[model samples]
Target chain A: MELLMAVSIGVLTACGIYLMLRARTFPVVMGLMMLGYAVNLFLFSMGRLATEAPAVIGRAETHADPLPQALVLTAIVIGFAMTAYVVILIIRGRKTLEHDYVDDRVNERDHGVAEQGLSKRAVAMPETPASAEADGEPRP
Target chain B: MSSHLLILPVLLPLLAGAVLLLFSGARLAWKRPINLAACVALLVVAVLLLLRATEGGAQVYVLGDWVAPFGIVLVLDRLSALMLVITAVLAIPVTLAMSAGTDRTGQNFHGLLQFQLMGLNGAFLTGDLFNLFVFFEILLIASYALLVFGGGRARVAASMHYVILNLFGSALFIIAVGLLYGVTGTLNMADMAVRIAALPAEDVALVRAAGLLLLVVFALKAALLPLGMWLPAAYASAAAPIAALFAIMSKVGLYAIFRVHGLLFGDMAGPLAGLGQSLVWWLALATMLLGILGVLGARDLRTLLAWQVIVSVGTLLAGWSLGTPEAWTAALFYMVHSTWMTAALFLIAGVVVARRGEARDSFMVDARIASPVVGLAFLAGAVALAGIPPLSGFVGKALLLQAAGFSGDMTIFWVLMLCSGLAGLLAFSRAGTSLFWRGPVAEVAAEQPPMPLMPALLLLVLSVLLVAGGGPILDYLAATADAMLQPADMIRAVLGDRYLPGGA
Candidate 1:
């Protein structure tokens, strides 16, 4: 049983790392979720992987370690929330930049041109590059 | 003061944040004053706690009346109290800055700020490793929202990277905690320390692996070299007040290292001796040098300040990895100094950006800013950040150098620290001259909105006070370092005599 769990964890980690190194936002987010799952499993297995054991005391002669279960449960909840937040952020990024690439320099260059074009205003607020691209105007 | 007062700093912020979330739709004018009042109250409570900690040795608070090693515990000692005071001090200026129009750009700014505070305060006080992980997630999630608050594409990109990187770090953190718990059969740090001390020799390798994993997690948060790639752009893109508040975030990671390493792994003869110390020492030096290079190459003031934050972390960790009480004391003093100075510099960068308008704090632009007050504030902040004499930075650096002299590798640290200071001086001078001296005269009579001078000025004043009150502060930090070096008091306070060989 321990060998099976260890092999599964190894595979999950390897897959997560491969996806996380991708350039696109979607793959990175997916990678993060996979990694989160791998970590949760690793944390769960830390209690030595008991079968047919009770979670609470007074139920069985030998009970499973409840602490790692509790810890992994908490981690899963937090990981789910973080994954949701990151998904929303990436969707917003795609909407604004019209691309899913997580490159800051490209975004900054486009945003900088927008700011320069709107320099007449005091704030010089950043504009969506998709709109600029739609207008077919060359950025400064 | 009741002993239960130890929980107030964390609880107050949690309650205030929940209340503020309910009032998120209220007018900014209404929410602003309440947030300011809560920050002031937190500051007062922090100061009182600091005083109480100075009088007492270590205060432990148990949840649900469960004994230590089984229940959650909040340990308050000199180190946690100092961290709390610094967090509170930082909160005041940052809250003021947010109120000065930055908060209007985002939703739930006040509530997120309060939640961030709760996370920081709780992270500093929690004795259980898992609890620390929980607080870390809370603060980090709040930071992510705050980072992308203004909804700029650049911010989105930066926040995504920051969030992803930190999420990885968090995953590693939980893995490490699990390994530690598996080995020790306990999650309480004090109890784990006792267990690790008694572990059989054959299990040392497993314990060392867990320890190294924890170090990697911390080094990521502390922005140590080879793991700090996300800091500069992420910090530069955030709103000014949020960036300033983040000045303490990296320090929280350093504090964890100091606390865990000092308490659980201090004995040199132990199995985990020399585990990651030499690696930390060299990485710290490299982080300092590379960060200074980043400062020199930065195109804008905010990015420069971001790189400077990395440099400051490097300097603090370099001193801390020496493993001497005096070195820890100096590191503690430098921690306080760098937090305020970097925060002040970030606030001043915002002021500069506001005045420069289209130039947007870019050093390549030559727009003249006519505010004498701002120019003076920039001058003071720049000088202090570069470790010039008569400021707190100078005092902190001197203390660090003195402490380094006692270590065997004094030459390397001295050369790197002085050279980094020189490099910082040159960068700040070049940037200052280009921004202030070489700019064209103001021609347009356009009326500018009033700059947020109060928070920046307050931070500057606090930096000056650090210089003026160096004597007493150093003495206090020295005592704090002494208490940190002796972790038995903390263990006893938390576990009573249960972990000790002979009980009362």
Candidate 2:
């Protein structure tokens, strides 16, 4: 069960990172939601693996670690609130800027916004001429 | 019964806020109740906490029957209570001065502010790491709303930067907590302190690394040097009262640094002893240099004051890094003093902005409407901030220098002092020339200022009183300083390890 949870977290993290790098505000928002899921699971798994166990004491067996479970519960609630807030903020930003793309306007203005979360490999290298032409950019 | 005072400090404002929320539509009526309750309750709490800290060493109040790591505990030690009291003392007047004349905001404003206070107090008093993070989020979320309460383009843009930075810090904090819990299997600060101390020499580095990661997050929150570019822009653009409230925020980070370094992870004899030397002290030196340059280069009064706050962070870090008992006292003393002084400075800038109706590039824009009282208040704040003798700032800096010692190797201390002195002269001289010496704004129609002179006068008087009473304050601080440096006191308090060998 712990391994499954860990695997799920890794999957969520990869998807989150991928979507977070997208140019639109919507994808970035979705990416944050995915990252929140991963964080929640990661936080929950820190107490180590316990299988076939309830969080409460029972006649047949002992309970799982109640502390981590409790922490995970709080994180879930806080995460939901944060996601709601970010969604609203994105909507507001879109309305104010009159654009749906996160990379528009503010990113162009701030300059650092685009560079903030990029992969080092992507940042270090410009696209090759064939790739640039394929992507419909100037080869030179 | 006295222990009950602890609950009241948190509960009173909370109750007041809830009541205010019910009257959200009442407009003008909401202001008086919120102002009065916030003022009285905070004053009472601040005084009571100080008195209790002086009389009884440190008291822990368990929320219910559960003990140890299971139940929540509110620990009221000298350091915790001192921070709480200072927060309250500054919070009340600033709140009153802010809400006095402004158009009524949403009734939720009072509730959010009080809730933020609750979170701050909780963060300081909490005995568990998870609880600390929980309260941090509470304060942060509420601060987000408060910072952008009355919407402006500048406010939103600046607040975006603020939120993103703090959110990143919070994420890092959570990750660090998860890693620490993985290793130790405990979240209680006291229990973790004991376990970490008992670890084998080889295993200690992981814990120290965890400590450093956590420190990095706090450093971000505290706006240390290079990490502080977000501060001046965000703070200078916010509403004055909100900016004033934020003066308390960085202290929470500093408080965490104090607690973790002095109590929980305080194996100063281990590999971590040099950690402060390389990380905190050097960072502090850089912070001072950058802060001075920023203050000098800043184009507006609000941003200039904001940059000064960054400078104060440097001062506090330098003092804390000294690690001597005397050094701790100086750092702690400077912490409280800077909070009030910065709040007052921001308030004065707000007043200046209101009168001129424009953000002036320098302090020297208009003079006729500048009230004598306001100028006097700014002068007092400037004098205190500059470390001029007979003011509170002088005492704080003097103690810091004494603590660091005047040995030739103390170049950091000397440079910081020299910069502060020069900055002090620059700040006051500019204000004097621009505010008092310059001609009045004869063209614009005059409007009566919203703030009652009473509150600003009260703050000025308090700043002066602190200056006069520095001798006794110094003595009291010295004792607390000694308590902080003595590893045995902290270990026993946190770990209950009296029977363990080498525990002392």
The candidate maximizing DockQ is 1
i-RMS, each model, one decimal: 1.0, 2.4
- Candidate DockQ values, in order, are 0.61, 0.25
Candidate 2 lDDT for residue B83: 78
The candidate maximizing TM-score is: 1
The sequence of per-residue lDDT tens digits that candidate 2 reaches over residues B1-504 is 775777666676667767666775666566566756775777787678878878877667777746665677777777777878877777776677666654343335666777788778878877788888898888888888777766665666666557656765666677678877888778877667666766668766767777887888888888997677788877887767678788898888888888766665565435455355457888988888888888787767778878888889989988888778888888888888888888887777666655654423256565444577767787888887888877788888888888888898797678777787698679667765675557765232245235544555556676777777878787778877776665455445544566234655
CAPRI quality band, candidate 2: acceptable
lDDT of 2 at B352: 64
Docking class of 1: medium
- Give the best candidate by lDDT: 1
